[model samples]
Target chain A: MSAATEAPLLELDGLVTEFRTGGAWHAALRGVSFALARNETLALVGESGCGKSVTALSIMGLLPPANSRIAAGRIRFAGRDLVGLSEEAMRKLRGNEISMIFQEPMTSLNPVLTVGFQVAESLRYHRGMEGQAARRAALELLDQVKIPAAAQRFDDYPHQFSGGMRQRVMIAMALACRPKLLLADEPTTALDVTIQAQVLALLAELKSAYGMAMIFITHNLGVVASIADRVAVMYAGAIVETAAVDELFARPTHPYTEALLRTIPRVDEDSAGLAAIPGQVPPLSAMPPGCRFAPRCALREAECEATDPALAPLPAAADHRVRCRVRAPATAAPRHA
Target chain B: MPEPMLEVAGLRKFFEVKRGFPRATTVTVRALDGISFTVGAGQSFGLVGESGCGKSTAGRAVLRLIEPDEGRVAFKGEDVLAAGKERLRALRRKMQIVFQDPYASLNPRRMIGKALTEPMRVHGVGAPGERVARAELLLAEVGLPKNAMTRYPHEFSGGQRQRIGIARALTLEPELIVADEPVSALDVSIQSQILLLLQGLQERRRLSFIFISHDLGVVRYFCQSMAVMYLGRIVETGPIPAIFKEPLHPYTKMLRDASPVPDPTRKVAMLRIEGEVPSAVNPPAGCHFHTRCPHAMEICRKAYPEWTPLGDGRGVACHLHKV
Candidate 1:
């Protein structure tokens, strides 16, 4: 339980990210907060438009051109607040101390640049190692990622590499500086199952070897189960539930989380006819006044519609937190389950 | 067993590629080297594989959407590949296809009613009034409200649009519907809704399906039996339970190992299959998967392994499974 007492490597408290859409500023991520310990894997799992990516973009300070910005919250990284940092200061931190990887490797990697040059360019820019030093380091990084015949394929273009191999190059570039924190946004979404496994295995191995903390954002729960030490289930722009990976799956505290875990069919087990959560995520503009998930919640009470429930720790578990009216509140008996 | 509902044997399709503009040498992509399978009537058969594995191509080749260079596609003992344009059109009414992308498949310019009714009108199924009635019934069957008939595709969400696509596929009352990655684009919550809906429809209509998808979980749930395709060949084919429990082919076993169970106690192990799938344009000699296979033998690179049938209606194409 040393992790319980130790200071988190990255702590986001009450992160409220806003996006300017249709002449209005809407909060896409409403008060998302989580802590990542050193060498920990925190999986941010949710469906599209659930603010999983927005949280990453906000953390990375790579929000889109429009007025998308973090309106509130403190992003403390190693005792330093990143929210108020200048672009120049943030730029220095990025790709050196904090690295990020996107889902689409084909689009993320420069098509015109050679794989070796792309990997080496980071080493040169971030580490100031030029010429042969950068090239040799790049080759070593590629080999570390287990790309077959890394020496021979140095000059190969992005188009020449397969989807899986191109992703390996992306990983090599991200790991070139050995950042303390890695923000991977659905890194293996576009890959085949086998290729995704290979990438994930490589990522896990690298994460442990480098002793880096990660905020892995993905929509797939199965992938989260495999790699994540902790899981944060988000819905409609807020963290609905957070728990240790095994405990959360064993006893899901939030109704949304419960529905979500039961919804998808698993390859390993026979499916009990899938249970749907019914309606879609509410639009940002038409966000309801009270509990955001009330309309879709099965155990919706009159009180649930009038007052918003703050995320609180579950009664039995100190670490597990949930933002649901039923099945979580210490005062409220478990009604839904 | 009465010639099966559909039988595809030794289906082959090739694509030509040219590199340079002036003096480009034409390269041949043997997309479907030779794949064969059978789908019983009222049964769902899965075509599982990763991207560029030719599962989609095989699905289309069976319906002659992309005419194969060789092999036979028989539907209910009728030669589908040999059918003329008129016969093909008639055959198409019996074997419709549900596309992977629901949003792109439907015409935005037309109303949902028009899109659903057009299929019935093309086949001259009934009078104009009856076709409209049938279209509404399809909407109801696919879990969409009747008011959905007048709305355009953009009005509905991805899941609703997919339901509309399923409705459109069901319009002609087709016997066999080819659902190509139907739920891949949907959210996990909605994916099961569609899968359940599809299963209900399958039971009620007795629709035989050629279910093609990359997600093995969805395939395992929806399909009774499946054929695992790799570089355009069925590496393993068997009942879903047996295949899931004990896969014979190295590629098939790797695929199973690669799929992560939604349980944190189960961590995905190190990959046994290495390297990316080779380009289909010039597949390797002998076993196409030898480049990545962990158990590749000396003979694997020289000669293609013969298909070994293990008497339980299950089989694999691998040197290790030689019988």
Candidate 2:
């Protein structure tokens, strides 16, 4: 309940998550570390199969049962290590201390139950409110999300709501507990452009109003550029770069990040064709050595194929950092110091 | 100027849904209500709209993929709707389709090599070795590695599989390709790559395209002309700049406003349209978007607005532009 200045709202220190597939273990998150400051919006930007969602799930302790395991690293929440917490302990944190909104609202929300009931169900379970109290609270949350006629639509099921409205309900449900941190995984992907904009703005407003630290995971640079305070570029199960939004966009250090920015269709510049990364993000099981992006990187060199790059700050900036074999060495020591 | 490759006039496809059982209540969905447009010999025409607005259905109806209940479709001056099965089959050589979901559209069991050559074989355009050579050329043309020929749909990433889909669609060497949300399923970075590939193929093959999508940004980049659909009908049709800069239709304005401005500093007031899309089976009586239009007039609620041209090849179906 204390201010997050003592420790981050959420911090993953050298987190490693793996899965057993094809009779062998596959590393989904390899020595990943990051922190979500209070009221900050950190975007995890990556293409499909880059483990952004997996990282989010790992933070929420919602990994699938198959062969999923957080092999190493500490997840500190309010200065307490949550990595080895029991299932009951973790469940207590979910929705009360932290909450998450999934990508597709249609699938995430209960179809048969009334949306009010579904939203209220979280309140009843977490805050121990029942029946009328829960319903009133749910209506209040919906009104807070600016859903018109919230009280009148309390009995209407999820199918009765539009895509955008359903997403609002989802956001309302996620924020019902007033959690300190919120994780949104591609919440606008399924909605139309207009609806997507509304949801993004609503999330921004809610984050500010609640003073919540938000981890927004999305593949759209446009979305990231709009809402993210800081951007984390991920490729093939690794954080390639992390920087303040303006710095990341203005001067991308890693070639992968640079190529990604180039590949985006800009309304300003006139280009013959997009600068493609040339190859797909390699399969997690068959990750390339040295640099995970070397095969697809345009600025690859001989040394890139021999060793992995450690994420470290650039010479000029204190916070901006990039992971690249050519640009960043394994150790932080200066080359000529 | 070269002759138009495709022309559509007053195209209408209505679906009558029978619901409830006492005597059977009926409702008519005006999916594509009297929409008209044309694509030049090698120009890309984009049709964009939210889901259930009937953009996909319109594309399918244009190609005679689905039998339209009304209106005219002409491909190279031949009436597509009136054409017989044999004529339509022959016309298939001039047109092909690439679907939005690459994995769903492509046969997962078949290898990429086979999928690329199957279309060419169906058209009986080349010999086995010739088909293989053409397939390899297409794979390379889409910027796929040579080794990708034998890979199955599951083996390739979403981007690579989309490239393979493009290669397959290009194998027939059709003059026009109806791409239905082709890049909507991929990442933003990969989407640009696919868009660039599509643009390149358009230039080299001199291919015309009917690109259908919901993203206005991508459409603006790829489409030479634009058409905005609402609840199953075209509300606005014009050049890209005209539509983006000065959208005449209320729905088009909302779409523009809704698009997330890449810059956080510039706050664009989203013209939020109230109410959900009316049931397709039982759409509103007049002006399909009237129920949700912010500037809906009384006439819009009672009578269907007439589609009028605003000159210079721009037209909007709205009462505000009745003049």
Candidate 3:
């Protein structure tokens, strides 16, 4: 691969995104960093208010302008830092080089406009395609997302579509430009299980066909297991663990990850009883001083409460990194040594 | 076995919705079409289905919160639908429901203590002082601190509010509780906490629960037996283990295959059926699932299949299983 191809398609270096609450800025994303390669799917797994959605908003430059801003760090997409880019410059990249789909398609889509017109708007805006060309492209995109009878339903409004069909329309709109990167935030969370399976399958097929890198943000571990190539488990505004999907599921290093895995009731196996983590995710404004998870972590140490732990790579596998004082110590010797 | 705690026979609920333009037509939405199930004393029976499949409707109908249009609901062999106003009011003390959204179910302005004690007060179960004591005890039982009683609903987190909801349900010492998606709104860690709490309450109180949920994993863990509904009809009904291991109805099989398991090795099954669930108002003729069933036959489209008993509390309503 050439150097350009070898480089990560998107990289976040110590990204800190903050939102102003009660007249004081509180960090929603605290020193979060990750790299996404071409055509790879990275799942951002976390509970609600864990800053997964905030991370996607940060990348898309969709964060609220009045109260929220990138406090520090860089968000580099294809060798360009998105943080300092002008709105005009960012607008050109958005929906062309990168696109996003939200959880509630009903809220995301324009109610008054026809589904076809909404989809074609993206093509006309990004690619400057007009008239017949844009319409044809939009129809094809709808068909690609497997919206049945795309031509017949093209003129139908958003309300005409069901929950699953509306989500298909949202996917159609996001994939219209064949963007290099796609940010899907709980795209199938609103749909039924059967519909969710179809959507997940469609996303997987479309990702490979388009060869697009994707950041899939969801709280569903089952979804993360199915769709993600690599997984970044977040908690209290930080990435607690990141590793290959198989390795992460097999050997979850972080205490939070381990506890979360045990908590989910599996359909495949008859779980005796789920082990519930006692404390909830701390509020962002009242975050703990040291390790954010130390208060709820089972393997907490005296030092854990005194100092925050850096995300350090495990000796067993360099790619499998974890943020913990006790588990993955910074001075741990490499396995090869 | 001892007489079942709750027996529902041909329970039906239909809603007439007005649609169209100037020449409007009354459409009959068959939310619960002749669904029947029994919950033995202290047994957890789950009603599982996708959205609009009528699981929630079934839960509501059994409690008579929404009066059913037809069929019989018997509590301990007592005809619930036929009960007089005073008789029904007494019966209400034994039957209660916990809604899905804890925030919406609770009154934001009312203190948690008031919410918990009000049901007891209405039923005239205890004196004012005793009701307050019981409210605090219930709060402690649900794992909430005593201080939580004085706080408003908004003061607590989603999980804490759910605990309050559960505590409120227990204020009347109901024998059968219709927990409609109680843990669905909670986070994974918090979901487990709530599940364990419910499980503990079930064991200690020996309460029977009619658990309603869309998540197969949650249903499997919480329910001993379950009925998989599709467009207001039970497609498959049996022990959770049997049905999960060998699903008879194609709809049940699809639901089982479609549910994403936490394990990465087991790839989510490619759903053979396509298209969203048909509208309940105008469900397809014959088997409602025929429109999506991969193995759908001419007979399936012409007439609904009869329930086929498989012995040992197992049954299926599908042409494929009709022997």
* Per-residue lDDT of model 2, residues A229-311, tens digit only: 89999988889899888888788889988888777654432345567667677887899889899988778899888888788
Worst 10 residues of 2 chain B by lDDT: B264-273
Candidate 3 residues lying further than 4 Å off, grouped into runs, are A1-5, A332-337, B21-23
| Fnat of all models, as shown | 0.81, 0.41, 0.72
Docking class of 2: acceptable
TM-score of chain A of each: 0.96, 0.95, 0.96
Model 3 per-residue lDDT tens digits across residues B1-323: 34699999899999999987668899999999999988989999999999999999999998889999999999999999999999999999999989889899898899999999999889998899999999999998999899998899999999999999899999999999999999998999999999999999999999999999999999999989999999898878888899889988888889988998877898688545587789999999988898888998999999999999899799999888867
Best by lDDT: 3
lDDT of 2 at A287: 92
Stretches of candidate 1 off by over 4 Å are A330-337, B1-3, B20-23
Candidate 2 pairs with clashing backbones: B31-B232
Cα error, residue B144 of model 1, in Å, equals: 1.9
Candidate 2, which segments miss by more than 4 Å at Cα?
A1-6, A267-273, A325-337, B18-26, B127-133, B143-151, B267-279, B282-286, B290-303
Model 2 CA lDDT for position B226: 86
Model 1 per-residue lDDT tens digits across residues B1-323: 22378999999999998865468999988889899989988888999998888999999999888999999999999999999999999999999899989889998989999999999888888999999999999999888999987889999989999999999999888999999999999988888789989999999999999999999889999998899998888999988999998888989888888888888887666555567888788889999999989899999999999988897679899999877
The number of the candidate with the highest DockQ is 3
lDDT pick, better of 1 and 2: 1
Interface RMSD of 3: 1.1
